[model samples]
Target: MKYDFDTIIPRRGTNSYKWDTPEEENVLPMWVADMDFHTAPAIVEALQERVAHGIFGYTKVPETYYDAVVRWFGNRHHWQINPRWIIYTSGVVPALSAVIKALTDSGDKVIVQTPAYNCFFSSIRNNGCELSANNLIYRGGRYTIDFDDLEAKAADPKVKILLLCNPHNPVGRVWTPEELRHIGDICLRNGVFVVADEIHCELTYGRHDYTPFASLSERFQQNSVTCVSPSKAFNLAGLQIANIIAADDEVRRRIDRAININEVCDVNPFGVIATMAAYNEGGEWLDALRKYLWENYEYLCHFFTERLPQYHVLPLEGTYLVWIDCRASGIGSDATTLRLQEEQKLMVNSGTIYGPGGEGFIRLNIACPRKLLADGLERITHILSKN
Candidate 1:
């Protein structure tokens, strides 16, 4: 089926975060991670079929749901996921909190690379764990992890878990194999567990291959818990379902206990159907979406290179979001975002919000119609030119 990624869909008044510019200000809401594109037709059909049954009572995920997930990882990424290792949660963020609570006691240090998913800090703190920062460095419009800092942090006895973003968010980096190996080795050596968030694993573009940290080595598997969901890949965040896959039996048991204490049983019925449909039948659509997103990335890259030289767009390897360096223009991400909002009438997220070292960079969500993308760039161009 042909996906209409070209048409601009009106998403306002649906309580969409993307369309929401301000508490009251009307600006194009492209700041959030959710795609403007609709979910795949197969997923919708499956949900409709399930809803037609007219039973919305307490439900359990059947074997087929787990099988679909396994097949998806196996076929697309060449990663084998055991059906038994999967634990369902409402969302990955919620699951992160649960895992922190499950794995560590209060005052234990949980390491997270900053300029990461903002909620990670809250999740760590909410679990009563002390948050430790391993900030990524920004150079030439792209971000890279400081392994020395990370290694030192990991080696610390107080630091318990590293919440790693495989294909990292805000600043897109599909971490290389060597990097993953080194990190995994460090974690294993230090007896630190790594909670790898591979949620954006499927959205990678070009030659970048996302290797699940747990799947790398036996030691890594023993020391890692990989979190994944169809939410980011299949545009089902609203349905709120994610899986925590722990390859180790002990870790799986602990996570299961966490789920029980948190009462995470009975995932959204619609989410189950949507997830199964996505994993089982939405491969072609995903491939096409990746191509579309890659094109959007390229279009934005070329546009900035030619028309807006001062604003350097980092080479995006994955995700629909692009990290832009507004520093060269003598404006920080805060000023850039404010100017875009109050002056140019556009909505974009300030990089500083992502965390430390995120200053002077802004993240723009390019997951929209080409026309909208073009319009946004043009508006930005005009705003910059006038300045």
Candidate 2:
């Protein structure tokens, strides 16, 4: 209520990756994970102060930045993080790549729950590791981890890591503590390391809670590298900053070396400021934003249920992205996305990009004003009504 989430901010000329990339004339981009809402007031004010100082030179991350991150997880998530366990990187994807390179050989395999964030595939492939997909089971309008497949894959001698998406993207299922423990136990038994990408950890809706992979147990903490960032929660992805928490000393050394080799250690000054501010002073705004995002998702679900019977909107427990099964609409995922863009001037992500189990689905980002969300839903309904 205190923030201006309803105002439509034009981003056409801002070089935004979400808005500027679409070649179409007036396409509404509900595709990307980033939100359309402005960041917290504290973050903006901190950036303004940093810019006003006017000295954009090589900078060292201050102690306060670490303290802010440490305090955030402790206060909000009840996870006590030792500041020594943290490694700064430009982004979570880069951190994932660095972790993969550091922990595994070229021929190693990485386990992933498919219908995941698309970048996980590239991060594994680009690091010269083969993808070992454990496709999640989609049933009863929700997604569940296929633990049997996960165990089988983890037992592979070549599989070295399990890249996790806690409070997962696309099919939004916030892993329960029991699920997290099961995953950690499977990896532990198979000598597979865990790389938990908890970027969407803070955006859970309702009673679903996010359990940091490291927060599960002492043994689990030792066997995992947890990635956290304020960029997704605060809509500051362009600033490019993330923290990699590696409690194991050897893994920490290897990751630090790989990050240096990749040249992603030189973080932008704005990112540092924004991250610290967002974590330290932006909790209220984040709470408000989460409420708005959840409401938008509820509206989307209701719209589909009441107006568009053919489409099945999945249960959205976390993140702003909604996964809708559009197969019943008599269209392929790619065709639906294309038609939405071309016919309705609306943009959404084709589910096939997230790997297997994603076909016949579409991922729509719902972190916008209610009016904009309504417009997108209407456009989708208009198209599906005739089907």
Of candidate 2, the 10-residue stretch with the lowest lDDT total is 19-28
Candidate 1: lDDT of 9? 78
Question: What TM-score does each of the candidates earn?
Answer: 0.96, 0.99
Which TM-score value belongs to model 1? 0.96
Worst 10 residues of 1 by lDDT: 17-26
Evaluate model 2: give its lDDT.
Answer: 0.92
- How far does residue 280 in candidate 2 sit from its true spot (Å)? 1.3
lDDT of 1 by residue, 286-363 (tens): 999999999898899899889887677887887788888777767678888888888778888898877887887888
- Name the regions of candidate 1 deviating beyond 4 angstroms: 20-26
Query: Which candidate leads the pack in lDDT?
Result: 2
**Model 2 misses residue 49 by how many Å?**
0.8
Report lDDT per candidate: 0.85, 0.92
Q: In model 1, what are the clashing residue pairs, if there are any?
A: 18-29
